[model samples]
Target: MNAREEILRRLGETPAEPAAYAAIPRPYLRRHHEGDAVELFAERAADYRAEVRRIPGADLPAVLGALRGHYVVPDGLPADWTAGADVVRDDPPVSIAALDALDGVITGCAVAIAETGTVVLDHGPGQGRRALTLVPDHHVVVVESARIAADVPEALERLSPDRPLTFISGPSATSDIELSRVEGVHGPRRLTIVITD
Candidate 1:
């Protein structure tokens, strides 16, 4: 037989077997450990270089008002929250340049993950649209204690799949080849998370 005929005959004689795939052993631990969710969240969030404050509900409005500089607040934020600072209501959709010029954006999170020290925003009520949060140089987030989840899985369970979610662990930063760190490359350089009771 010619070389091509010989090779084809050999290939036809070979067995055709389906490859077997071994199932990976996934030891999915639901939670890492047990601890006070709020305290753990504060501690973990602090470790990420984020300012975490446990504020009482009574002091929230005052604290928000006290936040220095001009800030853009979402449409549905409580009327009593601000105490006559240079606060602008983003009713008519603030321009991107306007948002960038503002001092920071104040928002309330949809859920907080204690284990990962993450603040998740669904852009609901007090939380403005995505641009309002991203364009500013600073971001001040207010998270309620009751909304803090024990872990990531728990947090996921709390959030709706359809909404636009932003998960922030710490300030925006990056490291270069020489290990030099730079802040505010893409997002806010400063992040302050206020955990309210």
Candidate 2:
């Protein structure tokens, strides 16, 4: 018999066996706790190697100014947020190739999943095209406390099927067979999260 047929015949004759699964350890889970959204956001950002900052809404424009030359891609960002800043606008023929040439991207998140320490992106105004955030070297995300959810399930409930969604968990990273960890292999190398109180 062919290999495929032989395997299938053996499987058909064999009885299903109960398998024991070992519980994986999660030190990260132990680190999480019920806390204020702002505080929790700050803690999680730090854990993910992201620089966390707090700023008033009025000061947003000034913050953009400081990040000059770092192409700013603001999603759902207020009109005044880019005042006096050298920001590039995302025009039609949406492609991230142009965004890849930028130094950084900034955007407001749809929701922050605290349990997974993840940020969800919806391609809304002020938050430019997804490529702006995905291809850049740096990502600066703004999260309002009200937008932070307690867990992934809660955040998923807030999302709609019709919208494009991008979920980010820390900066991009991978490990080699040698167990060496490397960062920024696929996405932004640096992530900065501003949690507005």
Candidate 3:
């Protein structure tokens, strides 16, 4: 047979088989050791250098009013939540440069993980687009006590995979080769979480 014919003949003689994927073993803990979810969440968030505040729902408006400078409010946030700040609505969507210039942005969260101290945003209701929280120097997050979970897996169960999810462990930070830490490189320099009872 010619070279081309010989190669085709050899290829036809051996058919490729599909490889089976082996199931990965999962032996890691699914949840953290039992403890007060709220206390654990606060402690973990503090460890990451995030400011955590426990405020009663009725007192939230007063606390929000105390923030200095102009701030933007995402849609669906309760009107009472922002009482005293010079607030602008993010209707047509603020420009990147404008967002940077603004004092900060405030939004509500979808869920909070106590074990990892992660706040998940799904761009729902009061939670605006990812840029609103990332571009500004300060990010103010409102999390309800009922939404806090004991661990990551618990948090994951409440989140939908299709929605765009942002998991914030703390203020944006990165460490260089020499172990020097830099904050706000990719996101807000300050992260403040208000947990409502």
Candidate 4:
């Protein structure tokens, strides 16, 4: 080895022990308001211009029937949820062109936050890949009442940190300088949330 390389190698070989990280104090509140997570979530979701519908588990078939166009769903979705509707299952992951041509997409969320009206998907069972939801013009999200949380922290606690998470508050929209609202800019133009008990 050269003299300079040997000297550099010797200098780099320090026997320093790793230090333990200090625990940071958590002073923030977990939840601010506490009434009904379902109610709060519905209210906030509506405020974001998303159509929120409440239905019983048994009525899913009827509600889905009213939705128009060619429907697509994740492979992990329950068979009974689709009922008699002709649905294209995304088992092999559809292309962007295919998803765009579809009328709408149906997905089940990992968790719903009442405080922020946010629905989170972790690409888990029933919730398809990110592109499946993004490319479609209409998105139908089914959220069980039992999976609702009061705040972000509660929702985060229930989700796995390593999973790919998608948090959606409302339909994709943007406004021009004169405040002319435009919908379906980068994501779905319409978001329909069905809350089930």
Predicted model with the maximum lDDT = 4
lDDT of 1 by residue, 1-197 (tens): 89999989988875544342224444677677587999999999999889989988888888887888999889887767665556899999999999989999888889999999999999889888999888899899888899999988778878987899999999888999999999889899999998888
Which lDDT tens digits does candidate 2 get at residues 1-197? 99999999988875544342224433443324576756766777688888878888777778767885746555457657667667665655335666777788778888888776788987767566666777888888878778888776567768875889998878877899998988878889988887775
What's the C-alpha lDDT at position 106 in model 1?
Answer: 86
Task: Give lDDT tens digits, candidate 3, residues 98-168.
Answer: 99999999999999999888899999889999889999999999989899999987898799878999999
Model 4 per-residue lDDT tens digits across residues 31-110: 97789999999999999999999999999978887787888999799888888676899978788899989999999999
TM-score of each: 0.83, 0.75, 0.84, 0.86
Q: Arrange candidates by TM-score, highest first: which order?
A: 4, 3, 1, 2
State the C-alpha lDDT per candidate: 0.87, 0.74, 0.89, 0.91
After superposing candidate 3 on the true structure, give the runs of residues whose Cα lies further than 4 Å from its correct spot.
Answer: 1-30
Cα TM-score of candidate 1: 0.83
Write down the TM-score for model 4. 0.86
RMSD in order of candidates: 9.2, 8.2, 7.6, 6.3
The positional error of residue 131 in candidate 4, measured at the CA in angstroms, is 0.8
Pairs of residues clashing in candidate 4: none
Between candidates 3 and 4, name the one with more favorable TM-score: 4
Q: How would you order the candidates by lDDT, starting with the best?
A: 4, 3, 1, 2
Candidate 3 CA-lDDT value:
0.89
